[model samples]
Target: MTIAGSDSGGGAGIQADLRTFAFHCVHGASVLTCITAQNTQGVTRVDAMSPEAVTAQFEAVMIDMRVGAIKTGMLLNQEIIKTVAKKLVAFGCGNVVVDPVMVSRAGAQLLDDDAVKTIREQLIPLAAITTPNRYEAQILADMEIHTLEDMQTAAQKIYKLGARSVLVKGGGFTNELKGIDVWFDGDRLEVLQTEVIDTPHTHGTGCTLSAAIAANLALGKPHFQAVQDAKNYVTEALKYSLAIGQGQGPVGHFYPLLNRG
Candidate 1:
């Protein structure tokens, strides 16, 4: 299940998550919490769906669909976060992937300052895995993360906060080095590194990665294996990204399908 907002540009958010799930050969389901008037350039406007509506969608999906795993993204406010968290626990869902989407690639704040505390306190502890980018890691852990060592420390700190596993993504780094995503499960830590492709078509990378992980989990892969496979999928998608709008475009989410074709 992909619980996120709709991206009118079809490059990020729910659109990208669904595309990533399809690429991974998993059935995709969504519960949209908001809608964004956005493009490759940036988000122009946002319309939040009412909490009642969000709950209705969740009920509709859960009652009819047999979801094996769930992924959440872009829940803008504390109300929405609390609502979703309650439903997850009520429904007894497993294999939950939480992508703490706090801000957009264009630097627009997607999550409110007040919502961060709610997410960290209420929602994160219930997740099977929580994926946070460097900036998000800093916010969630309340620290400065500038290096790989810092990422390791932050991952551990976050684990102590209640997450079963943590993946600290290093995509926001300004240095000209390979991208490294660190994963920690309290007892073990692994760095999944990939050559960073210098490209502007990476609009929905975080959403895509989390969705890919959900898809793999639904297919019954182990947590570490699912993360590794998702990382590889995102790497290929970025490598063959398509140039769309005037600003940062989107990765080639259909790369595998296109290759098959």
Candidate 2:
């Protein structure tokens, strides 16, 4: 299941997440925390759901569904963050893949300082694996990330927060360094790389990658293998990105289906 916001444009958030789960052959479920009036042009307004409503969704899923794993994206505020975290623990939901969604791929700030703090303190520690893009990693680690060494440091620091593993995504890097992700699990540091697909329609890449990781975990793949598979999936999706909107669009979640013919 994915606990995330809704993107009315259907490029990211719940739309991308469910599609990603489907591609992995997993039954997808969602608990929406916010609804955004957005398109490829950019996000305009966001309306967050009440914490009670959010918890109600969690209860419904936990009771009825045999959820193998879960991922979180675009948790709107501290109330929602704490609420989701509390319920996850109450129900003994493990294999939590946290996508620390504080910024957009275009470098827009999607979260406030208070919400960032809550994610760091409350949500991240509960993660089986936490995937933070370059900008989000910099914010969480309290350091500027410039080189690969910095990414390694950030991964280690984020792991110190109690996540069993950390994936510091480098897709934000342009030119030669693009599409490299740093993985660290307190003992070993590994870099996962993919050939960058040169395309403007790369929105929702972060959301899709994390959701893919969650789906792989649900299928019982181990930590490193899951992250690696998700990275490869995102890279391939980028190759088939759609040019649907006036601005940047989304990676193709059903690219494999396109290849199936």
Candidate 3:
């Protein structure tokens, strides 16, 4: 299940998660935390839901559906973050993937200081895997990341925060580490990278990656394998990304079906 915001463009947040789950042949469920008035250009407005509303959605899914895994994205505030964390533990949802949605790839700030702190203290500890981009990693690790070593250090630091594993995404990095991701499970560290697909239709790459990982986990793949599969899926999506809107289009989640021109 994807516990995230709703993207009106239908290319990210709950939309991306559900499509990703469909690609992996897993049934997707969603709990919308906020509604984003956005498209390829940028987000113009955001309307966050009440904590009680989020709770109702969580309980509705947890009680009725036998969800296999969960992925969280775009939780707009501390209340939503803390409440989601509580529900995960109470519902015994073991496989949790936390996509700390603090900022956009375009370097836009989407989360505030208090929200980040709450996620680090509450939500992250409950995650089986946490996916944070370079910027998000820098915030969580309290350091700048310009190299692979820095990625490793950040992963270790985040792991210390109580997550079983952390994948410090290098997609935001420049130089050699671009499109490379560092995964550390408190035991072994693995670097996953794919050939670069030159495209600006990467609006929801992070969300898609984390959702794919959750989908793979739901299909019973191990953590490392799930990440690997997700990387490949995102790469393929990028290769065939749609040039839908004016500014930056979203990755083609249904790329498997469309013939790229």
Candidate 4:
């Protein structure tokens, strides 16, 4: 299940998650927590759904479907976070991928600051893996992350904060280096690095990546292998990205279609 806000631009959030899951040939399900009037330029408005509505949607999905894995993004407030956390435990959901989507690609705050503490304390512990981009990692770990070493350190710190595993993404750092992601699973540290594609069409990268990981997990791949494969998928998606809007466009989610051409 993809628990996220709806992006009207179709470049990120629930839209991106569904496309990524479809690209991986897995069934995609969604429970929207909020809706945004947004485009490539930025978010103009946000409408958070009622907590009751959120709970009802989750229950409706859970009662009827067998979701092998679940991914969450852009749950805006403290109440929503607590609601989601409680429902996940109640449903006995496993293989949860929590993409701590604190901000939009345009640097707008998607989640409230008050919700951060609740997320870290309540939601992170239940996740199989939590994917946080550089800025989000800094926000969660309360430190600056500049290099791969910093990412590794941040991953460890987040793990100590109750996450079963952490994947610290390097997409937002201004280092002009390769895109590096660090993973810590409480026992060992592993770094997955890829050449950064110089493309402005990377609007939904974090959402897509985490959803891809969830899809791979549902397909029964191991945690490390799932992350690696998802990274590769995102790299190719970036390479084949299409220039869609005036601002940051979207990655070509179905890159395999291009290979067939």
Q: Estimate every model's Cα lDDT from 0 to 1.
A: 0.89, 0.92, 0.91, 0.89
On TM-score, the leading prediction is: 2
Query: TM-scores of the models, in the given order?
Result: 0.96, 0.98, 0.97, 0.96
Whole-model lDDT, candidate 4? 0.89
Candidate 1, superposed: residue stretches over 4 Å from native: 105-109, 176-178
Error of 2 at 203 (Å): 1.0
**Lowest summed lDDT window (length 10), candidate 1:** 103-112
Report the lDDT of model 2 for residue 223.
Answer: 92
Clashing pairs in 2: none
Query: What would you estimate as the lDDT of candidate 3?
Result: 0.91
Error of 3 at 38 (Å): 0.4
How many residue pairs clash in each candidate at the backbone level? 0, 0, 0, 0
Model 3: per-residue lDDT, tens digit, 24-61?
89999889999999998878999999999999999998
lDDT of 1 by residue, 1-261 (tens): 999999999988999999898878889999999999999887899999999999999999999989999999999889999999999999998899999888553345667778988899988998899999887888888898878889999999998888899999888887642488889998999888887788878888999999999999999999999999999999899988989878888999888777889
Residue-level lDDT of model 4, residues 53-133, one tens digit each, is: 999999999999899999999999999999999999999988999998785433456566789888888899999999988
Model 3: residue 166 alpha-carbon error in angstroms? 0.7
| Ranked candidates (TM-score, high to low) | 2, 3, 1, 4
Runs off by more than 4 Å, candidate 4: 104-109, 176-178
TM-score of model number 2: 0.98
Q: Report the CA-based lDDT of candidate 2 relative to the real structure.
A: 0.92
For candidate 1, what is the total of clashing residue pairs?
0
